[model samples]
Target: MVQSVKPNPQGGITVTCDNKEEHFDKVIFTSPLNVLTKVADSSLFESSKPKTPVEYLGVICLVLITKSSLTPYYVLNIADKEIPFTGVIGMSSLVDLDQTGDEHLTYFPKYVSANDSYWKKSDEELKSLFLEGVSKLYPDFDTNDIVSAHLHKAFKVQPLQVLNYSEIIPDVQTKHKDFYVLNTSQFVNDTLNNNSVVNHVEKFVNEFKTESNLQ
Candidate 1:
């Protein structure tokens, strides 16, 4: 059960987690808005956290091994489908393509939220489908050449890009004197943006320290 905050006469709050008790004068809540809603009512503070208006397609990438590197280009932009989801990235994409070596790393978009017939399939079934799609994308690639394969599923890998999100997310500081909530949404759209996140962090740390009286 979520811990509750007592009346002002008590002057202190009790928080219990996994049978452990801890006392604190202040707390900074960093849980996601969705998760925070599941928590019990807190009269200690009144903060409005809005539901994030973004969603994304989940993916289960299937990495393929090759004797010779696929392409010096890190990514193979799969224009349109003969496949689902989006493009394919070379497994060797991270390694220097100019290096004198054989073997390449490549994986394809094996899952798509919109076209999720594959996710319903068994792992082995998915692997075959992945191999087959990869082969189609790279005709020279032999399905048998894939000596090993693995599945990597990413949940909410990135946020769906939309427009005009400025009005939704509010300032980090709540109307309450001693409460704040911060998350990726505060920094960027559904996905985190570099400059905004950095700026938000700097401001948040400063604000938090000022409110908490930190060193």
Candidate 2:
């Protein structure tokens, strides 16, 4: 069997896993545009192809385990740059547990960028920095009280919302024969849960049925 997909002509792909060389009829990629442009066969689209720019940020969240309770809030969004990382959250806010009566303090410092020097350090060092951040947030916090530490690292946490994002919305059903593409990120500008893509799906369904000469 053979599969064909179209977008930009400069399509290049590499299969990382060891799998049988079986073929298919069609493939739909639901990845970022930056990556898609590479795997897409640009020529299939003919005239012009709309492109969008996307930037991402990495975040490292530190979970500090303490012997005392912190705050009542679940999410703490830190907007201050001087604080090194983002806000902290009390784990108890989300999970329910026996009120051991003994206090439990849990918070995290989110480093916006992974390239920072802090990211270069060992896990224990990173944990220490996180505890340090907590002390800074609350001067009365004692670093010695921390009994455990945890770290969570996530890439693409925040995508820099680019301008003119509305101008690049693409139709899944293109003029090319048997060529269709759908990306949730493209429809995530002003609406949530890819509302734009949902609307496009509806339109595509109607058009596809009509194009197929189906009543």
Candidate 3:
């Protein structure tokens, strides 16, 4: 894992990985923006960082393996604010049933902030709440049909867009000419998806080559 990144006086960049240092002419950061703030050395960038720290929302996912199908629809979004789970995804409906041995797979996802109370709940508590929410969605939902269940969590899933968000985004090229930051935080007027990521990379490559006079 990359431990930190610092400026090299030899007109390049120095990156420390697993305690060893490596040199590079340039580096393109693709990880979550929040991670950069943590890993980057204070002396790495000579310019000021973002005035307002960008906030991000995390996610909790409860996956269920069942003996039978739960819902016919591929995806269901719960608009009602009272529900604990925000969305239900039927994985078996999208993938081939044969791959899952004819069993059904479902996902219940909830988006929450870092300090949300949901993070304090134990596994059993989360499972109970999610099961109750699922039961409300399908009154006939049977607990006996569940073969197994798993829980997953991510701390920095995506950025929370705020007022004048685009204006506050850091420039691709920082004060240090050899260092650059590129990630979803730079995305404007586009959804965060594979296509948008690919497009952003392509544009950055073209612009960088022209600006640096790379052959």
Between candidates 1 and 3, the lDDT winner:
3
CA lDDT for candidate 3: 0.82
Task: Estimate the TM-score for candidate 3.
Answer: 0.72
After best superposition, candidate 2 residue 103: deviation in angstroms? 8.7
Q: Each model's TM-score?
A: 0.56, 0.53, 0.72
Per-residue lDDT tens digits of candidate 2, residues 51-77? 654555566878766776666787677
Q: Give the per-residue lDDT of model 1 (tens digit) for 7-122.
A: 23334444555656555555555654444444423554454554464454567888766667556666565656666435677657677645525566776764366456766778
Ranking by TM-score: 3, 1, 2
Better of 2 and 3 by TM-score: 3
Badly placed stretches (over 4 Å) of model 3 are 5-28, 40-48, 174-182, 193-215
CA lDDT, candidate 3, residue 10: 83
Ranked by lDDT, top first = 3, 1, 2
For candidate 2, list the clashing residue pairs, or say none. 8-41, 8-42, 9-41, 9-42, 9-43, 68-103, 68-104, 68-105, 69-104
lDDT for model 2, on a 0 to 1 scale? 0.58
* Candidate 2 Cα errors over 4 Å, as ranges: 1-52, 98-125, 168-215
TM-score, model 2 to reference: 0.53
